[model samples]
Target: MSFEFEKELRVTETNIPGLLVFDLPVHGDNRGWFKENWQRAKMTALGLPDFGPVQNNISFNATKGVTRGIHAEPWDKYISIAAGSIFGAWVDLRPGESFGQVFTTRLDPSRAIYVPRGVGNSFQALEDGTVYTYLVNAHWSLEQKRTYTFVNLADPELDIRWPIPLEESERSEADLHHPMLRDAKPMAPKRTLVTGCNGQLGRAIRQYAEAHGLEGFEYTDIDEFDFSDPNAYDKYDWSLYGTIINAAEYSTELCDDTDNADKAWRVNAQGPALLARVAAEHHIVLVHVSSDAAYGMNKESKTIAPVSLYGQTKAAGDIAVANAPEHYVLRFDAETLQDSEQCAKEVFRLLDEHTAYGIRDFS
Candidate 1:
């Protein structure tokens, strides 16, 4: 195996302190092959601190439309493709600093992306034979991890040239002609909020909105708010805002442990409940972000199945929000915001097949 960073995934600067990337070698013959995807000793040799992984996740996708990530948490992760291949992308989502900047790489059986805590990770399968796996130092927390949709991650002007060319199809045509790719736009203004933040999607939303000026919204981490106290709402004046985005969570742990289950429910379910109520009472639009995990392990189902404890709790939160007339519940899985060029290219591709050949509209 050979190791090289994807030309697009380089970091200009980061407060993350340290990030290490290594290429694990593969030994193959006519009979079969062997590769050491992760070796703690090897990582340590490469100068990475030996904080071992606590959780391992494997995701398999079929067909090119099978996009599964933009997944991340506050914990450090060692990510590699065990079976097939994928175009892995990483973006720093930590607030009060440089955010929305990306480092992308083609993670095949040959390469990997080492994502530290506070950075966002997502990927698309270059082909059908793709199995994306990751090792997380922190275990699953329904409240801790967050998901965003694909549209949120496209940045046209960023010009992230993948090692492989993206397939063109009607669905992705508009993205191909996005203005940012042709003529990038100035970075959007960052927004600042004081309460109910810190989860993955929340951080992404905060960073994305600030970077793109989509809605002129800003977010603050949990440290900035004391939602545990009912009186917390009384301290902030809410009249100036047009929308309230709630991404805060109390737990992300998913297991049979009753304590873990209860905590996940309380934080993921109850916390959002309180925030939605406040937003409703204040007459602000509550954009309560949610996840597909609520559907459980039945990936085969056409719809989500809330099976696990985490799923059950998130489902409960979904139900609560559904009951709230003033709230707009947005359910997303693996989201990103791309620059204009990528956006335009995607758009152009989508419309090209429908229009007459040799005639350019340019409108």
Candidate 2:
């Protein structure tokens, strides 16, 4: 059978953020047709994120009208057809304004879609021998499977007009049992990890997050998450966080030339550097506080010229934290602050309002 031959490779933005539809070029001749299912460099250049894929998964449908999903998995996926066609339906299941928004389209060997981590994906086989393949950034594990968010495929709220009626289509019993859109909880966004919860700033941030009913934030102190220890980083799943706020620091004034200087360096400089490295590896955003002292007595100074031990260590930490691929080195005057609560509010406000990376002078 002859199919439409080579078209320019392109991508279309769907209603959902980060969800993209791709048009692939297929070259067909007398023998058969061939296509490059995924060309990373070209796709990334076309606004697709360079999400490092670690696993490839495929699903096969033996008969027409077979159907699956409405599942929101924890990992991003680039899905395409290897053979035949499918009627694909996607629903945004992430928290915020787009929740429950739906987009539906038909996919053939010439088309594909990028499903962000929290979007619910479902499809119906429009032809027999349908082979659906996807590449994901994370390797699937039983623990990860437990984090899936699901909604009923036939939920009236979604009101998807399947090419083939779902009643006559093949679906798993588990898929059949999912809750309606109204009843299903929107998948939570990546968690925020707050370090040094015992500290004034940390406590204030914690209180603010709680009072505002912000979910998916884990607050911890040195006892729970000792940044000075490398083993502490290994104990938790780094993928769970989208941001790490490092409030942990040794701000003691008594550390001048004593053994406490080593402790100060470990907590203030080395610890932040280590966290920044981890954040870089996981593609997570790192948020670190830099002292005004790091700039010496000249408040207008942008360069680091510390005159005190505390300032010196903080300057070193600032340099190290800047190494992260995405980071915010927040500099503000603690002495001028009326209260930690006010500082907390501004920190969150800046986080919400700004997408700009690098040093953010809150002062």
Candidate 3:
């Protein structure tokens, strides 16, 4: 698809399939300079994942010629130099074409690189106090076993030519003692992610899990994981969960707005559909919690006539789940609760423990 990017941005596709360099336009005036670092809409238009970042990391170098990394993981990365400069390099480690070929670039604070999965990445600072920041798309859970595959920067077999001599560079103890990529094994996911913890179904699931002594489940709320971002729900090891319970929904009246309608489709429809496809691919069971909104003013179970955009999106989500090879959609009413006593007990438990507590006046 042909598209026009923002004037301030230039996406340069590298020789590597998924690697791309973003040259940001810096506006310099009499005072200072400014640049738009990241925009999901723009990134998506340019064929990049449009998900909210799962993790943000920063690495600071105290001296020039200090090298860190040649590390590879199971997820994609957005790396940008925030201060000073570095001779950054990324090597394709995916078994097959371009297995050991390296891509080298001189990175300053203004430029950023998109590193796809299965790439060994490294950098050597050219200036003291150089800062590097990376945005990753994986939900990190240390409890599950994970092995970080690494390659020696000066490996003769890989023939990765460094800009400066290795004798002149300082390396970390871990880097000096790491194993080769070919000998490494992939990491396993630790737990199933239960998103939308603040919602009714999510809270019920967490309470049930805690009461039953069930473990290996990660609880997250809307604040932690935004479902609308296309890249928000990927890179998790599907083998971790037999069944993924999706209790999240966007049921606000704001869906009536034309601008907000797209968000509803993204969250309630496309997001769930993608999740279902992933689950089916790995033979994981997906128990998707849907809404009565899917029924709307339809005549029977098969026919659907959505009265509102919210209902339309919910119906779309249901259809998405139905298309999956192994999926179960549970339609329910969110307005009524079956466990008022249990909720009250939990609320009272909170009130008794805290000195400063919030008591809302419910009319």
| Order by lDDT, highest first | 2, 3, 1
In order of TM-score, best first, we have 2, 3, 1
Residues forming the 10-long window of minimal summed lDDT in candidate 1: 354-363
lDDT of 1 by residue, 1-363 (tens): 233322222222233334445566666666656677787775665655454576899877766645433433556677887766777666555442445466766767766667765565657777766788888765565534332112223554445555444443112443344332223232222222424446554555545545654444556655656554466667665433335556655444444577677567666687677666765554444555566667676646735578767667777777766544455554544232113233223322433342221112221
How far off is model 3, as Cα RMSD? 15.3
Q: How many residue pairs of model 3 clash at the backbone?
A: 0
What are the TM-scores, per candidate, against the unseen true structure?
0.41, 0.91, 0.54
Mind sharing the TM-score for model 1? 0.41
CA-only RMSD, every prediction: 20.9, 3.0, 15.3
Per residue, candidate 2 scores C-alpha lDDT tens digits across 1-363 of 124569899999989988999999999887888999999999988978777787999999999999999899988899999888999999999877889999999888899999988999999998889999999977787867778999999999999999888889999989999999999988876778999889888999999999999888898888887897887888877776678988887874644767689888888898998998898887678888767878887768587888888888888999999888778887777573337787787779867875321222322
lDDT score of residue 352 within candidate 3: 31
Mark the regions of model 1 whose C-alpha exceeds 4 Å error after superposition. 1-17, 146-151, 162-363
Clashing pairs in 2: none
Which regions of candidate 2 are displaced past 4 Å? 1-3, 252-254, 297-299, 354-363
Alpha-carbon local distance difference test for all models = 0.53, 0.84, 0.67
Residue 232, candidate 1: how far off, in angstroms? 26
